[model samples]
Target: MSDNDSQKRAQFLAAYDEQLRTDAETPSAIKVIVQGPLRLVTFLNGRGFITYKNLGGADQAAIQRLVPEAMAYYQADAEIIRVEWKTRGHDHAPGMHEALIDNGFIRDEQESIMIGEASALAVDVPLPEGVTLRQVTEETDVRAMSAMQDEVFGDPVSDDMAEALLRRLAIDPGMELWVAEVEGRMVTAGRLELVPGTKFAGIWGGATREEWRGRGIYRALTAARARSALNHGKLLIHSDSTEFSRPILERSGLLKVSTTTPYYWKR
Candidate 1:
């Protein structure tokens, strides 16, 4: 990469870590506890999450000690059946991986952190014939969208996810849910969250049916969300994208700023 490109990536990563590593990322948390540099969050759906802007320059020993302490906090809460420690590849923590593993956390797949101007993704992308895109707000539509995403991601189709999404919409109606459908059947879907107090908006939960892949349906859905983000005055777009979606977003002008891996633990 050219020096100019490298510098731009650095700036985007810096902005992401600074603006997104706070309560902005956990707007739906029911409870948040601060333990040193760790933000231990509890959600209504029996999930615990851990993240931080940085490690406060802590060394290996400090990180090892902090890991179990954070775990014990969540363990005491029977309501939290599972927990995830979010790790950033660009972070300087020395022994975070070992610490998490030793504490019974299992590493999940790593996703690329993509960021760039929302306008770059707002360009027109033609959808296949009979496919249409629109924003969904009703409960039935939300449930169908969540079910399609769960099926696409290989998770069991359940009402838990739909319930959580409905609750989230109740809390922040500004969060936009977009979907691509063919003749009244949902084929692709995703979400747009306009982060308060920042210029960034996140595109998340992107999923397209296997048969719908490579048809430009996902790209068109993404463009619609990007246009909505731009309409809401959000200039920057960010997403932790899987390998399947990373190349598409890269082609849409977002840079791969870094990587994030989630470590999961269940009761």
Candidate 2:
């Protein structure tokens, strides 16, 4: 990358860490505990999440001590059947991976942290023949969209995610769910979340069916969401994208600001 490009990436990453790594991340959490720089968030469906804006320049010994202490905080809460410790590639913490593994946390695949202007992605894109995009608000449509997403991600189709989404929608009107359909069957799905008190909106849960791959349906769906975000007064867009979707966003003018990996622990 050129020096100018590197500087731009640095600026984007800095803005992301400053604006997004705090309460914007866990807007709907049932509870949040502050332990030093860490935000231990308890969400619905027995899920606990851990994240920090920065580690305060902690050394290996300090990180090692912090990991188990955070783990214990979740372990003592029997209701939290599972916990996810979110780690970013740009973080300065040393021995974080080993410390998490030592505490029975299993690392998951890493995803690119993509960020860019929402207007850059709001352009009109033609969809595949017979494919149409729309924002879904009804329960039945939401469940269908969630089920299709689970199937695409190779997980068992269940109501757990749909239920959680419904609960979230009840309180967060800023969260919008968009899906692409063909002949009344869902082929692509994702969400646009307008973060309150910030200039950022998140495009998350992007998934497309196997048969729908390589088509421009996903891009069109993203454009629809970006337009929605822009309409809602959000200027920037952010997403933790898998390899399948990262290239698409990069092509749409989003930058790979960093990487995020979630380490999981289940009781």
Candidate 3:
């Protein structure tokens, strides 16, 4: 890899770590916005969710303290269930994965941190002759997008996920949904979140109709989203890709720097 490539990757990782610290998790289980010299993100998701930019600057005692406080915050509510601590291998986080394991939090499968220059992904791609693309932000359109995405991803249809996404869109948080249609039927769709307070935007739920693969529709939609991200001043684009989407993203110049996986803990 070239020096420029190395620098870009480092910058992308640094920004990612910092964004995790500052992003407002959600309305779920009151939020505790912790102030940290490095980067820290704590969320109340039943148990507790803690992830920091890196552990290079923190001692073991500091991390241990953080865990108890985080647990207490989540435990305050009887409804809270379980907590997870997300870790990144490329981060300056020393002994973090070890610490979580020591504390009874298990590690999950590593997911690739795919990042690339926005410009490289801004090329124009034409959809198949019969298909076209449209943006979905309205409630009905959002539901359709969600349903199609669920089918493409092999997840059970979830009205709750649709409701949550609609709620988020209602706030006009700059989240966008795009769809590919053939003869007036929705075939594939995805969501792009223009995360506020960060120089990066994320593409999620990029699903293609199994029969519609390799028709260039999904790529065109992704390009359209990339152009939008660039207009929003986001130079870096990121996604947690699977086998299907990873190759397509790699073809667009995004590198898989690391992996992330969520391990479930049930009450």
Candidate 4:
């Protein structure tokens, strides 16, 4: 990376760490419970999320106290069976990783935080013959798409994911569920979350069938979503991308700002 590109990435990381992550999270949660410096978010279907800005500059002793306390907050609720503590690479909280591990949180693989101008990704991408893309809203289509995504990711079909998507659709119309289908069968799917009151829209869960990989369908789907985000007045697109999707986003002009690792604790 050039010096200017590195500086730009640093700036984006700082803005994202301080502002976008927390501000965007609050509006999406069904309930946000604050514990000291942490925001304990309760999502639909018994999922819990723990995050905070800079851990409020906590020292080692403070981090040790806060880590378990946050986990305890989730454990207190019978509905919350799983909790993920979202960590950023740039966070300065001492012994945070150790604290989470000691408290029974299992670490998940890290992902790159990709950000870029929405307009940069709004270019046209040719789709394969007989493949069609469109936004989906109905529960039947939503469930089908979710199941397809689960199968693509090597996880069993999750009713919870389908239910959560339906619930979110009822409350938040800003969310767009897009799918690419061949002859009416789902082949690719993803979600675009337009953060209300922010310049960012997040593209998540981009999954394509193994047989359909390398056909430019995923890229076309991303472009379609980016066009929609731009139409809705968003200037930037962000995603916590896996190895598979990272190169696709980079091809669309997004820069890797930082890394995020989610440490999960199951009760």
Q: What is the lDDT of residue 191 in candidate 1?
A: 95
Per-residue lDDT tens digits for candidate 2, residues 129-224, read 888899998999999999999999999999999998998888899999999999999999999999998899999999999989898889999999
Name the TM-score of candidate 1: 0.98
Residue pairs in clash, model 3: 46-81, 47-82, 48-83, 55-93, 110-259, 110-260, 111-259, 111-260, 112-258, 112-259
- TM-scores, in order shown? 0.98, 0.98, 0.81, 0.96
Question: lDDT at 85 for candidate 4?
Answer: 90
| Ranking according to lDDT, highest score first | 1, 2, 4, 3
Candidate 2 error regions (>4 Å):
none
lDDT of 3 at 111: 68
Residue 50 alpha-carbon offset, candidate 4, angstroms: 0.2
> Candidate 4 lDDT (Cα, whole model)?
0.90
Instruction: RMSD for all candidates, in order, please.
Output: 0.8, 0.9, 3.4, 1.3
After superposition of all CA atoms, the RMSD between model 3 and the true structure is 3.4
Give all candidates' CA lDDT scores. Answer: 0.94, 0.93, 0.71, 0.90
Local distance difference test, candidate 1: 0.94
- Residue pairs that clash (backbone atoms under 3 angstroms), model 1: none
